[model samples]
Target: MMVLLISTSIMFSCKEKANVLKESIEADIIIYGGTSAAISAAVEAKRSGKSVIVVSPDKHLGGLTSGGLGWTDTGDKSVIGGLAREFYHRVYKYYNTDEAWQWQPKEEYGNTGQGTPAMDGENRTMWIFEPHVAEKVFEDLVKEDSIRVDRDEWLDRENGVVLEGGNIKSFSTLSGKTYSGKIFLDATYEGDLMAAAGVSYHVGREGKDVYGEEWNGVQTGVLHHKHWFESDISPYVVPGDPSSGLLPRVSAENPGEKHSGDDKIQAYCFRMCMTDHEPNRVPFPKPDGYDPMQYELMARVFDTGRKDWFQKFDAIPNHKTDTNNHGPFSSDNIGMNYDYPEASYERRKEIIKEHEQYQKGLLWFVANDPRVPKDIQLKMQKWGLAKDEFTDNGNWPHQIYVREARRMVGEFVMTENELLKKRKTPNPIGLGSYTMDSHNVQRYIKPDGFVQNEGDIGVETNGPYTISYGSLVPKKNECKNLLVPVCVSSSHIAFGSIRMEPVFMILGQSAAAAAVLAINENTTVQNVDYNKLKEVLVAKGQIVE
Candidate 1:
């Protein structure tokens, strides 16, 4: 009987170790994001000497950081510090070796590098590379640390269980894998985990009235650029035939009258990676269900003798280009993404496929159509998809350019005052320097019977501005273990600047520091001492300024 009792005790002890109690596998911190911020946060959490786990919905990490926005949008490189600086330094390293410039001449590679400071030698940053290269860097982070990583483990927002009495007990994923951590970080771009935990969040553009933001919500009359000049332009489909109605994609409405805003997110598109070198290029394949009629408006713009249409795809290094929507009726599919923020998973898939088709079709239209000027077509012909990138996803990019979406409405809502370089918050965790940029949200048919665009607001950030710490914290009543880095609490206009990848990493490092500090104090992430947080951030070489 004594021997039997001892055996039972041993069995229970083994089982307990196998299934580490909520506090065992729970780690000191848990981050829900697959974006750059998420990875940086995880890396920082480990470096800060805390066990961490990354539960990401995305199969591939680095969001847009590794997606396609390869040309970093670095305003003042001096302000970049911590993991943000390290990321660029890695990019510099990727390009320093002669093997990196396989397609172009060593000298023609322009050692000067993408209009930024030299990122050469061991302390370099290979800032420009294929999406796969960026993913490799993120992979290196996990390999470097014995940190736990669960990919495609989407937080079961509703009914996933975030036990909160201002502290998270455990949150379950769709896989039924429950993660219990002392401190949680919602580093996701969508803030899904935070929202599911009953945290307050905003969808679409807040009206100018709510935030008193000049660039918030609907701006029907503000025309930033003229890529589609219907003044002398013909229609995209067929010119001068109202009986044929408008193009398939062109909306025939007068957008909206509100000055502030409604719940409409900005237009989204894929960032195509193109190589000018033919050997490296995979010519734009004719997308299935391709239609030339949809691009009739584009052809009409070309007919008007527009030369600046090609300027949108800004040139980058190694014979590559960072494509951006330049003028009116550019690459962005305006007004069509109104339901995306609250869209169901399947519906979001449909939206992404539609965007892919639109982008692919646009490339085909430009590549094969006779309407495109010969010289311009020739220039475009030199470029094609990077064959090495997005290998499993049919040469199409896995991550869509979700420029802005589902910003959290948390303890501190960063408004235009913060973005326009006006007010400073005491709980600042990071700084954003990008402009308040939002692409055209809606397209409308004018009274003149021509299409007009609205909602493309671009107000540059005057200087570096602090991102509030409250932005990361969920309401004290909601789950308190979480720290939001990507979808931090902010007005739509303000999030644009804070949306940069470098800024995300900076925020990620700061967020991890805060999360670990919370675990040590056995308090909510909100109650972390700001002075200590700043000290750790600065000591870690993070430019909190």
Candidate 2:
């Protein structure tokens, strides 16, 4: 009888352990992402007297900001406020100290930025910085707030999100860890959580008629930036021989009609942080699949006597650069990454690996290939990957420049009309003043049979324009307790302006504030009082105007 009782007690204890393991992690707010917006949202939520947890796929905290996009894209600096501005102030404080400038003197690194001073002493903000500095800042922000973050946790897109009466009850990661929250924030660049939650979203470019705006769809002729080929370059492998087939990286498909939409997204590339400081530089490693023929198109571009190869090696601090895609055949891996937005995690990893290989091979080809111009080759050989950046990722940027991705079709769709000041934005939550920029989408054979790049649009906005609060929340019927800050509800052209990192941080804080207000009032995110939200935002140092 005693032996039978011991067996029963052991069975009950095992059952209790299983039940405890199955219990979900509960919080007042849950944020999914590790971007700048995610960190800002988590911090703001914690400050609002709510328990918040950040489930991050990335091991590192800040997305592109710390991942080598050190050169901040600030259109109008005064419009930036709240925690976003505070972040820059923190950067300023770090740079103000003598120890911050290790490799270069403070006086040597001039205050040159995008039409403004990089380090604004009057405003106490530093726009340009190094990768490690930005990461430290983000880490400190969350650490000070005591917010919980679970790193390297990927969302199970297939069956992760659980909805009960149009509200997200909980979501599970691939590791079988579930989190239940009163409100959720999808701060990812790809909008994985939003899409998994059955929220409405558009993947690629939309027709001009869909948004009633120019520069929305397939722009075959409208090349704004210097990314297009200047001189005529043949797409054929054997120069002008059509039967020789097309060279690599050149698409053969029809680039669609102008102003008409098809499923195509802008190119993606790694914003490499390179340095000429020999002691702190690691020579660019040749990728495993080093194919010189892959960059034959670039060789042709260099053959055209184009010497502006170093135009976009923008300097940040300590002799390091936020090297971006510059010329026609530079870093932007055109005609790729179309299906990356909605692809599965495994497929996305493959895509990211391909991008990394392509970029690394491009660097090798430019530096070592005999086909490249001697001047450009010699200059490229001088620069190498910064040894201090992305230590775990082989000195490469941890985050890829996912310029555009799945955009949610939510309560209000901001179009170029709003950015151009033709239509006024209502219920302003933040401000964006950057140009409506889109990178080259396709590199295809023109109708005349010459190689030309398409879908690079760069239309300037009408100064600082207000971003609507409705853009962050989904429609009333789709989901009730979710807000998206990174992939907000905006048309392609409008999102081009709103997708800036600082603006993302601004929207993140606003979204968290709205989430807290909704939780307190026992209401949906769509039902949050705009007046109360705006008041709270203003009180918290957010520039609503």
Candidate 3:
């Protein structure tokens, strides 16, 4: 009797373990992210006749696209194709309706974009749109395809991924839900899944020598944008007194050698979706721990007769604006997010909150502070947060503009040479033509004890350059079944151009197609035939030139 009872207990224990490991949801492809790339990948996977699941960390769909980055950074609209171009076409269709324009009429919203018409009638595509409209388009894309999206499902980065023979077998989330798949795609901006999978990746800037690129690393005394302190402003709390202590936001450390390597990355900021319309404007709330002293440097910048505060308030539909970091001291919180790429989730939240507080405080200071120039203050006061956008998050964007992060060091690493037309890209999958841009990395005191900004680059590419297929796959030895579209394999300078949302969508579609081909051939993503992949890409409206 005792032996029989012990046997029963052992049997039950083994059964429970099996149940725990069993995947709650299984599919042909499992995508980890909620960004625009994730949506595009999921849609493509479904269109390819495969079961797909998106384990999204965010409740929302689009990352920065629907997160206040309405002003598209499209370099050459002609090169954008596949689902990416489809997205813009959907936007154009939405705006063609009478009800789409709520706060303003379609005629009043002029066809102004970044050197192109906002609504390109000939191509039936719209580049510029409001945040809510972008989100709706993303939501519709998923809904139309009937894609399974598990929202707010945070990946258990510590012990989630289960790999077998260089392939991911399954991964669990914080909710204890196991997801099994034939192939995996990491579409997050931070490359969380890629890093968690133990694939090789690099954070921050690589030295110019690392990739033989001119704009890869630390760039002191080289200011391409207007985001530098043109005037001689002292870094000290009290002007010309080093003993008085450094002012807030100004770094005390040594700005590294020019063109040398450093761990610093470009500054990040909330692309504030603001509106001057009285009916739909919500005043910028004073953040929880608002401090006026933080804006003293900004006030000093204004004192220098710089009236370009509203320079980057790029217009969108509905009388709204996609306000980005402009002048010397604006939205880009300089020198505050070095550890964000690899920080713990809790720590990242803290950092994001700090950025939010800093930006909100900056807006409040500009609108109400006595030190601000009366002319600028009056103009700023007219603008406020769009009442209808991001209503769940206090009318502030949920996604931060994480311009660059963990770039994978995979089988092929794109360099400035490829973008500059010096070296030809192999196994082209998509195209990118945006300027090799990087926001200011650090703000430090110059050799003469004056304040200055560093690491703001804006070198235009030769033209539309092809993106290599290898840039999306890992070295076969590292991870065979995993595909990374967002944090692609490229040098920092090259990633500057590839990090655009349209390119991400393009890569996402290409990655999904590659994943399906790999599954069909029973081979690794690295082993998928380039010719077969290119055929599918072109057939699916992807311009791979």
Query: Which sections of candidate 3 miss by over 4 Å?
Result: 1-23
Candidates 1 and 2 compared by TM-score, better number = 2
Query: Residue by residue across 304-339, what tens digits does model 3's lDDT show?
Result: 898899899999999899999997899999999999
Candidates in order have lDDT scores of: 0.76, 0.91, 0.92
> TM-score for all predictions?
0.91, 0.96, 0.96
lDDT of 3 at 125: 96
Residues 151-263, candidate 2, lDDT per residue (tens digit)? 99999899989999999999999876788889999999999999999999987889999979988999988878899999999989899999999899999998888989888
Q: Which stretches of candidate 1 lie over 4 Å from their true place?
A: 1-25, 111-126, 226-243
Model 1: per-residue Cα lDDT over 386-441, one tens digit each = 76678888767888888887888877899888777677676777777777777777
Candidate 3 overall Cα lDDT vs. reference? Answer: 0.92
| C-alpha positional error of residue 383 in candidate 1 after TM-score superposition, expressed in Å | 2.0
Clashing pairs in 2: none
Report the CA-based lDDT of candidate 1 relative to the real structure.
Answer: 0.76
Superior by TM-score: candidate 1 or candidate 3:
3
Ranking by lDDT: 3, 2, 1
Error of 1 at 333 (Å): 2.0
